[model samples]
Target: MKRDQARRAYWSQNLRYLAGLLLVWFAVSFGAGILLVEELDQLRVFGFKLGFWFAQQGAIYAFVVLILVYVVLMNRLDRRYSRDEEDPA
Candidate 1:
Protein backbone atom coordinates (compact mmCIF):
# COMPACT_ATOMS: atom_id res chain seq x y z
CA MET A 1 0.00 0.00 0.00
CA LYS A 2 1.00 3.60 -0.47
CA ARG A 3 2.25 5.54 2.52
CA ASP A 4 -1.04 7.40 2.99
CA GLN A 5 -3.02 4.22 2.63
CA ALA A 6 -0.74 2.44 5.10
CA ARG A 7 -1.07 5.28 7.57
CA ARG A 8 -4.84 5.25 7.32
CA ALA A 9 -4.92 1.50 7.75
CA TYR A 10 -2.73 1.77 10.81
CA TRP A 11 -4.97 4.38 12.40
CA SER A 12 -8.11 2.45 11.52
CA GLN A 13 -6.80 -0.65 13.21
CA ASN A 14 -5.69 1.35 16.23
CA LEU A 15 -9.07 3.03 16.60
CA ARG A 16 -10.95 -0.26 16.31
CA TYR A 17 -8.80 -1.85 18.98
CA LEU A 18 -9.11 1.18 21.23
CA ALA A 19 -12.90 1.20 20.92
CA GLY A 20 -13.22 -2.43 21.88
CA LEU A 21 -10.87 -2.00 24.83
CA LEU A 22 -12.81 1.01 26.10
CA LEU A 23 -16.11 -0.84 25.81
CA VAL A 24 -14.82 -3.70 27.93
CA TRP A 25 -13.37 -1.26 30.42
CA PHE A 26 -16.69 0.52 30.74
CA ALA A 27 -18.57 -2.75 31.16
CA VAL A 28 -16.26 -4.04 33.84
CA SER A 29 -16.06 -0.77 35.71
CA PHE A 30 -19.57 0.61 35.39
CA GLY A 31 -21.60 -2.51 34.79
CA ALA A 32 -20.04 -4.62 37.48
CA GLY A 33 -19.38 -1.79 39.88
CA ILE A 34 -22.57 0.22 39.76
CA LEU A 35 -25.25 -1.07 37.38
CA LEU A 36 -25.10 -4.73 38.30
CA VAL A 37 -23.72 -4.30 41.80
CA GLU A 38 -26.54 -6.15 43.50
CA GLU A 39 -26.27 -9.16 41.22
CA LEU A 40 -22.50 -9.15 41.29
CA ASP A 41 -22.40 -8.75 45.05
CA GLN A 42 -24.18 -12.08 45.43
CA LEU A 43 -21.40 -13.76 43.52
CA ARG A 44 -18.05 -14.31 45.21
CA VAL A 45 -14.52 -14.51 43.92
CA PHE A 46 -12.20 -16.06 46.51
CA GLY A 47 -14.84 -15.42 49.17
CA PHE A 48 -14.79 -11.67 48.55
CA LYS A 49 -17.81 -9.56 47.65
CA LEU A 50 -17.62 -9.13 43.89
CA GLY A 51 -19.46 -5.87 43.48
CA PHE A 52 -17.87 -4.10 46.42
CA TRP A 53 -14.46 -5.30 45.39
CA PHE A 54 -15.08 -4.25 41.81
CA ALA A 55 -16.20 -0.82 42.92
CA GLN A 56 -13.35 -0.34 45.36
CA GLN A 57 -10.48 -2.12 43.64
CA GLY A 58 -11.36 -4.01 40.50
CA ALA A 59 -11.89 -0.92 38.37
CA ILE A 60 -8.50 0.43 39.33
CA TYR A 61 -6.89 -2.90 38.61
CA ALA A 62 -8.65 -3.11 35.30
CA PHE A 63 -7.48 0.38 34.45
CA VAL A 64 -3.92 -0.60 35.18
CA VAL A 65 -4.32 -3.74 33.12
CA LEU A 66 -5.76 -1.69 30.32
CA ILE A 67 -2.78 0.64 30.39
CA LEU A 68 -0.34 -2.23 30.29
CA VAL A 69 -2.31 -3.95 27.56
CA TYR A 70 -2.42 -0.80 25.50
CA VAL A 71 1.29 -0.26 25.87
CA VAL A 72 2.13 -3.80 24.83
CA LEU A 73 -0.40 -3.82 22.01
CA MET A 74 0.73 -0.47 20.68
CA ASN A 75 4.32 -1.56 20.75
CA ARG A 76 3.44 -4.55 18.62
CA LEU A 77 1.37 -2.40 16.34
CA ASP A 78 4.17 0.09 15.92
CA ARG A 79 6.56 -2.70 15.01
CA ARG A 80 4.02 -4.23 12.65
CA TYR A 81 3.50 -0.91 10.92
CA SER A 82 7.23 -0.17 10.85
CA ARG A 83 6.56 3.09 12.69
CA ASP A 84 9.14 2.70 15.40
CA GLU A 85 12.38 4.56 14.88
CA GLU A 86 15.31 2.42 13.85
CA ASP A 87 18.72 2.65 15.44
CA PRO A 88 21.53 4.11 13.39
CA ALA A 89 23.34 1.38 11.51
Candidate 2:
Protein backbone atom coordinates (compact mmCIF):
# COMPACT_ATOMS: atom_id res chain seq x y z
CA MET A 1 0.00 0.00 0.00
CA LYS A 2 1.07 3.60 -0.51
CA ARG A 3 2.58 5.34 2.52
CA ASP A 4 -0.21 7.92 2.80
CA GLN A 5 -2.88 5.28 2.48
CA ALA A 6 -1.24 3.14 5.14
CA ARG A 7 -1.00 6.10 7.50
CA ARG A 8 -4.63 7.01 7.02
CA ALA A 9 -5.74 3.46 7.66
CA TYR A 10 -3.69 3.28 10.84
CA TRP A 11 -5.14 6.55 12.11
CA SER A 12 -8.69 5.50 11.34
CA GLN A 13 -8.24 2.27 13.24
CA ASN A 14 -6.81 4.11 16.21
CA LEU A 15 -9.60 6.68 16.26
CA ARG A 16 -12.32 4.06 16.05
CA TYR A 17 -10.85 2.11 18.94
CA LEU A 18 -10.51 5.27 21.04
CA ALA A 19 -14.05 6.40 20.32
CA GLY A 20 -15.55 3.04 21.26
CA LEU A 21 -13.66 2.94 24.52
CA LEU A 22 -14.75 6.43 25.42
CA LEU A 23 -18.35 5.61 24.60
CA VAL A 24 -18.33 2.67 27.00
CA TRP A 25 -16.73 4.84 29.66
CA PHE A 26 -19.41 7.46 29.27
CA ALA A 27 -22.22 4.91 29.30
CA VAL A 28 -21.07 3.29 32.50
CA SER A 29 -20.06 6.45 34.31
CA PHE A 30 -22.92 8.74 33.43
CA GLY A 31 -25.67 6.54 32.18
CA ALA A 32 -25.58 3.90 34.86
CA GLY A 33 -24.37 6.07 37.69
CA ILE A 34 -26.60 9.10 37.27
CA LEU A 35 -29.35 8.29 34.85
CA LEU A 36 -30.15 4.81 36.06
CA VAL A 37 -28.90 5.00 39.60
CA GLU A 38 -32.20 3.95 41.08
CA GLU A 39 -32.33 0.78 39.08
CA LEU A 40 -28.68 0.01 39.68
CA ASP A 41 -29.09 0.66 43.39
CA GLN A 42 -31.56 -2.20 43.47
CA LEU A 43 -28.59 -4.45 42.75
CA ARG A 44 -25.79 -4.80 45.28
CA VAL A 45 -22.30 -6.19 45.26
CA PHE A 46 -20.87 -7.03 48.67
CA GLY A 47 -23.27 -4.53 50.21
CA PHE A 48 -22.00 -1.67 48.04
CA LYS A 49 -24.36 0.31 45.87
CA LEU A 50 -23.62 -0.64 42.28
CA GLY A 51 -24.30 2.77 40.83
CA PHE A 52 -22.34 4.63 43.48
CA TRP A 53 -19.43 2.26 43.20
CA PHE A 54 -19.37 2.67 39.45
CA ALA A 55 -19.47 6.42 39.70
CA GLN A 56 -16.66 6.59 42.23
CA GLN A 57 -14.36 3.60 41.65
CA GLY A 58 -15.48 1.49 38.71
CA ALA A 59 -15.13 4.29 36.17
CA ILE A 60 -11.60 5.02 37.37
CA TYR A 61 -10.67 1.37 36.97
CA ALA A 62 -12.23 1.25 33.53
CA PHE A 63 -10.22 4.29 32.49
CA VAL A 64 -7.02 2.64 33.64
CA VAL A 65 -7.88 -0.52 31.70
CA LEU A 66 -8.59 1.59 28.63
CA ILE A 67 -5.15 3.18 28.85
CA LEU A 68 -3.45 -0.19 29.10
CA VAL A 69 -5.47 -1.54 26.17
CA TYR A 70 -4.54 1.46 24.03
CA VAL A 71 -0.87 1.13 24.84
CA VAL A 72 -0.83 -2.55 23.93
CA LEU A 73 -2.79 -2.01 20.71
CA MET A 74 -0.55 0.87 19.64
CA ASN A 75 2.53 -1.24 20.19
CA ARG A 76 1.10 -4.01 18.03
CA LEU A 77 0.11 -1.54 15.30
CA ASP A 78 3.57 0.02 15.33
CA ARG A 79 5.23 -3.36 14.89
CA ARG A 80 2.81 -4.35 12.15
CA TYR A 81 3.43 -1.15 10.13
CA SER A 82 7.15 -0.77 10.71
CA ARG A 83 9.26 -0.59 7.56
CA ASP A 84 11.44 -3.64 6.91
CA GLU A 85 14.45 -1.79 5.64
CA GLU A 86 17.69 -3.78 5.37
CA ASP A 87 20.97 -3.12 3.56
CA PRO A 88 21.55 -5.26 0.48
CA ALA A 89 25.10 -6.58 0.36
Candidate 3:
Protein backbone atom coordinates (compact mmCIF):
# COMPACT_ATOMS: atom_id res chain seq x y z
CA MET A 1 0.00 0.00 0.00
CA LYS A 2 2.77 2.43 0.89
CA ARG A 3 4.67 1.55 -2.27
CA ASP A 4 1.59 2.06 -4.38
CA GLN A 5 0.94 5.40 -2.74
CA ALA A 6 4.47 6.53 -3.35
CA ARG A 7 4.27 5.49 -6.97
CA ARG A 8 1.06 7.42 -7.43
CA ALA A 9 2.53 10.48 -5.81
CA TYR A 10 5.53 10.39 -8.08
CA TRP A 11 3.44 10.07 -11.21
CA SER A 12 1.09 12.79 -10.08
CA GLN A 13 3.98 15.16 -9.59
CA ASN A 14 5.36 14.17 -12.94
CA LEU A 15 2.09 14.83 -14.68
CA ARG A 16 1.70 18.17 -12.99
CA TYR A 17 5.10 19.25 -14.21
CA LEU A 18 4.33 18.06 -17.70
CA ALA A 19 1.03 19.90 -17.79
CA GLY A 20 2.54 23.15 -16.55
CA LEU A 21 5.37 23.03 -19.04
CA LEU A 22 3.01 22.21 -21.88
CA LEU A 23 0.78 25.10 -20.93
CA VAL A 24 3.71 27.48 -21.10
CA TRP A 25 4.75 26.00 -24.41
CA PHE A 26 1.27 26.45 -25.80
CA ALA A 27 1.12 30.01 -24.57
CA VAL A 28 4.44 30.83 -26.15
CA SER A 29 4.02 29.00 -29.42
CA PHE A 30 0.35 29.40 -30.15
CA GLY A 31 -0.57 32.48 -28.17
CA ALA A 32 2.47 34.62 -28.80
CA GLY A 33 3.33 33.29 -32.22
CA ILE A 34 -0.11 33.41 -33.79
CA LEU A 35 -2.84 34.85 -31.63
CA LEU A 36 -0.99 37.98 -30.61
CA VAL A 37 1.39 38.27 -33.52
CA GLU A 38 0.04 41.50 -34.95
CA GLU A 39 0.09 43.27 -31.61
CA LEU A 40 3.51 41.93 -30.74
CA ASP A 41 4.92 42.77 -34.13
CA GLN A 42 4.89 46.40 -33.09
CA LEU A 43 7.75 45.63 -30.71
CA ARG A 44 11.30 44.89 -31.73
CA VAL A 45 13.71 42.40 -30.22
CA PHE A 46 17.34 42.40 -31.33
CA GLY A 47 16.22 44.26 -34.43
CA PHE A 48 13.67 41.55 -35.24
CA LYS A 49 9.94 41.92 -34.86
CA LEU A 50 8.90 40.28 -31.61
CA GLY A 51 6.15 38.28 -33.22
CA PHE A 52 8.32 37.04 -36.04
CA TRP A 53 11.08 36.07 -33.65
CA PHE A 54 8.65 34.17 -31.48
CA ALA A 55 7.14 32.42 -34.45
CA GLN A 56 10.54 31.49 -35.83
CA GLN A 57 12.94 31.22 -32.90
CA GLY A 58 11.46 32.10 -29.54
CA ALA A 59 9.23 29.05 -29.37
CA ILE A 60 12.16 26.79 -30.15
CA TYR A 61 14.20 28.38 -27.41
CA ALA A 62 11.35 27.94 -25.00
CA PHE A 63 11.07 24.30 -25.90
CA VAL A 64 14.75 23.74 -25.20
CA VAL A 65 14.39 25.45 -21.86
CA LEU A 66 11.38 23.32 -21.09
CA ILE A 67 13.36 20.20 -21.86
CA LEU A 68 16.06 21.31 -19.47
CA VAL A 69 13.46 22.10 -16.83
CA TYR A 70 11.92 18.67 -17.24
CA VAL A 71 15.27 16.98 -16.89
CA VAL A 72 16.10 18.88 -13.72
CA LEU A 73 12.69 18.31 -12.19
CA MET A 74 12.65 14.62 -12.99
CA ASN A 75 16.14 14.22 -11.61
CA ARG A 76 15.07 15.81 -8.38
CA LEU A 77 12.05 13.54 -8.22
CA ASP A 78 14.20 10.51 -8.88
CA ARG A 79 16.63 11.45 -6.14
CA ARG A 80 13.83 12.09 -3.67
CA TYR A 81 12.15 8.77 -4.41
CA SER A 82 15.42 6.92 -4.29
CA ARG A 83 16.08 8.38 -0.89
CA ASP A 84 12.61 7.42 0.22
CA GLU A 85 13.36 3.85 -0.80
CA GLU A 86 16.62 3.92 1.10
CA ASP A 87 15.06 5.22 4.32
CA PRO A 88 11.50 4.34 5.19
CA ALA A 89 9.16 6.26 7.44
Each candidate: RMSD to true structure?
A: 3.9, 3.3, 1.1
Off by over 4 Å in 3: none
- Candidate 3 Cα deviation (angstroms), residue 82: 1.8
TM-score of each: 0.85, 0.83, 0.92
**Residue 46 displacement (Å), model 1:** 3.0
For model 1, what is the error of residue 35's alpha carbon versus the real structure, in angstroms, after optimal superposition?
A: 0.4
Candidate 3: tens digits of C-alpha lDDT, residues 1-89 = 66777788889999999999999999999999999999999999899999999999999999999999999999999998777666667
Better of 2 and 3 by TM-score: 3
Candidate 1 C-alpha lDDT tens digits along 1-89: 35666678779989988998999899889899999999999989987799999999899999999989999998888887775233222
- Which 10 residues in a row give candidate 2 its minimum summed lDDT? 80-89
Pairs of residues clashing in candidate 3? none
lDDT of each: 0.85, 0.79, 0.92
Winner by lDDT: 3
TM-score of 3: 0.92
Model 2: CA > 4 A from native: 83-89
- Model 2 Cα RMSD, 1 decimal: 3.3
Query: Once model 3 is optimally superposed onto the true structure by TM-score, how far is the C-alpha of residue 75 displaced, in angstroms?
Result: 0.7
lDDT of 1: 0.85
lDDT by residue for model 2 over 10-81, one digit each (tens)? 788889888988898888888887888888888899878898888878878888898898899989887765
